[model samples]
Target: MSRKVIGIVMNGVTGRMGYRQHLVRSILAIREQGGLPLADGRTLWPEPILVGRNAHKLKEIAEQHGLEHWTTSLDEALAHPLAEIYFDAQVTTAREHAIRAAIAAGKHVYTEKPTAETLDSALELARLARDAGVCNGAVQDKLFLPGLLKLKRLVDSGFFGRILSVRGEFGYWVFEGDWQAAQRPSWNYRTQDGGGMILDMFPHWRYVLDNLIAPVQSVYAHTATHIPERVDEQGRTYPATADDAAYGIFELAGGVTAQINSSWAVRVDRDELVEFQIDGTHGSAVAGLRNCRFQHRAATPKPVWNPDLPATESFRSQWQQVPDNGEFDNGFKVQWELFLHHVASGTAYHWDLLEGAKGVQLAELGLRSAAEGRRLDVPELTL
Candidate 1:
């Protein structure tokens, strides 16, 4: 079978997510699998070149990963004849400049979410890519998760009829970088670095809602930086300028109210990175990042929600762990292969750049709402 050589110019490959998720797992894993099969009996694998500002880090990563090509100069790498795709996982604040350069180089572009920090910048990038006639996309990894897949199945099967609402609990206690290693990048705690819970994650909910439940039509949000002070990698305390916690209420077209509580301040008291409760008239379902369970009205114990109830285990047992049914892969990696398949074959990927922009749009509106202290209308966009 013929194979398309897809050379990927990857910027910020030395960063945690850039190296781990995009480089080693997505790109190298595709090479390890002998490329993804196309619809027309063809195959495609990313010939990835690591690009970053840190020479030592880039060299070490490439050496450890058995990738021969690495470059500190992004311009030089972009000039390579074989580089058809340019990817960026740089810091959120720096993403636009790199992606804009890639678009100028006539390469198809993909990057991690919050396409740009501002709505206008994101929309402008979309316009540039569209005018250039090149494909572009951003990472919306959660929609491809296994647990979400199960949740999607339950929702599609009418298990959650007359869906009432969805409540999301996400985050664990992040390290303060004083004694223990910080769980996230230091920039995430600073607003100047394009860091904040709302900007970082509202996009995930946008696509998840748009695809699975309802398109977000309006938003009312509140945000805060609970920990006013944070210790950096050098153990120097800095004033936290970003909102580490976000509370958002979204109104969908279907009247399915969705509430999200995102944080970097809370300690985990649950079994998952994200837990969702979806209650419907016919039944209700709860799903996490790893497991899914449900309860139907048939299984209910026939008790009304009371103000003075102590405890009950009847409805609890009805919710059981979803069985393992198929081979599982990293959510981001799965989406990457889907993108390759769509590019090499007639098959198409469900998530695209426009969908990615929709996510960013939600975040943008969310910020506006938080700032103005009022609900904001999300203007619809066209492809």
Candidate 2:
């Protein structure tokens, strides 16, 4: 069988999402599996060179993974003739510069969401990638989650006839560091560091709504900094300037209404850390990170509302579980494989830098809506 080795420059993977999801879970997993198979009787193997500012950490990670390349000099990595793709999972604030450098170096670009801190910059990056004639992509990992995949299947199969509304609940209690230690990085609590619920998550909501249900036409949102202060990783306290919670209402194309609540201060009461419930005229389904449950219109139970009486019906069990018809791979890994195929074989990929810019646009609009306390129409973005 023919084989192609594609060298990738992996940056900012020393961070949480970068380290776990992109580097270890995705690229490394792909390498472990003997690379991705192709339609033309060929296998595309990835040769990833870890790039980060921390020399010691990079060396440690490379050694741990039995990887041969790790470097502190991004320019040096970019200069490598074998490196054709530059992947960034850096902090949101640092993404634009690194990506621009990679593009200038004529490398295909792929990165984690919210392509840039602002919509303008995000658009500029998209323009640059197109001008340079390089294949580019942005991470929309949520689309590949098993639950969301099943939800998409149901939607495609017309099970949810005339989808009416969608409700998304995301987040869980994040430790304040003073007591149990904060679960997230301290940079996430500082706005200057590109930390905030609206900026971080609205991009995700944008893509999810646009692809799964419908394109978001408008947004009305309320955002808050519920926790004003938190302890840092170094055992120091700092003011939390970013919004810890965001409650948003999105109007989608085809008149579907979607409401989503994202908060780090809230406690979890659902089956997963994130869940989406879609209601339609014919059926209703709730999908979590890994599972989906549904109740058809014919099977939905009717109960009389009695505030004075204790309800004895098993409401939770009334919905039937959506069976797992096939084994699912890690979401991040799946996207990586698709991207590799796109790079190797010129396959059609919909999630480009322009799509990433759309996500940034939504976040910007959401913040504006929250600040003005009004609904805002989302203008269509074009190349």
Candidate 3:
């Protein structure tokens, strides 16, 4: 019976994740579905202003979508009549300035990860938002993932009773495109552009663990870049300065140790990549991005750790695929809907800016520990 129009000013909306995930899959998708359903038979529709620096490109996008609101100036967009929320998908290095400006303008925020470049800076942003008394959040998209959500279900249901440890293997060959077209963005391979595996992925893992598995207490890590050079679009070769691979071991608050292997160098092999192997004292589960299965030993398997002897037999065949829990949409859309709801009704969403900052903190410490060659204690933030 009532409609609340939450205006969202989205910065850096023309970039890859900004365009595909936030704009198309999340916002426009919500609009296409006639806005999100409300509890009392109402609906909330977001009035989104696409903000970017390129005038021609912004006009092209607006024309393509028949969107009336598009602007080249961030300040002008923020000053627009209907803009209420400020969303940023800008590069990590650019996050702090944009966020400060947004907070000063008295708008709520939702943005991509590595919320700021370092732990201290990220925490500051969180505090600033709180001081300004605005509902602040960051994109923790992994928690909305269907497979990971199923894994969380199994963990919550005591199916994996007394969890032991977690192992994550996430990678695919990201070609430098010297011989062919490059598979990933050139910024992802350059440190100066705020790119690296430790920064990029450990944030995702930190939240995933806290949400589904456990809270990380300490971390030890080492980072490497196997391929040190890449050719860009302009046929210029740049020395790779970011870590292409990261191996990290995290001890959870409950003492469950997790080893996460993230790489841009490894070739894809499995049905869909990004698998997590979660083991409990009574059972073990392996989850791919799209599929998850588990095996309950019912007891314990009697096996000796002998390299010479034949490895355990028929272990893989015992596990069964877990059925999908419910109808799922795009993970990004799930987060978007939750955010819109929070904006409308003030409902609590677990993955707020602080949680996102924790993710950034873990990443900051992971890389620091790698450089220092020692396990680092993660400090808790009050804000």
lDDT of 2 by residue, 23-56 (tens): 8899889888988999898988899888999999
Pairs of residues clashing in candidate 2: 177-181
lDDT of 3 by residue, 196-274 (tens): 9999999999988888887788999999999999988777899999999999999987879899899999997765679
Candidate 1 lDDT score relative to the true structure: 0.84
lDDT ranking, best first: 2, 3, 1
TM-score, per-candidate, Cα-based: 0.95, 0.99, 0.95
- lDDT score of model 2? 0.94
lDDT of each: 0.84, 0.94, 0.87
Worst 10 residues of 3 by lDDT: 296-305
lDDT minimum window of 10 residues, candidate 2 = 27-36
Q: Return the TM-score for candidate 1, rounded to 2 decimals.
A: 0.95
lDDT (Cα, 0-100) at 221 in candidate 2: 97
Clashes of each: 0, 1, 0
Q: Model 3 shows how many backbone clashes?
A: 0
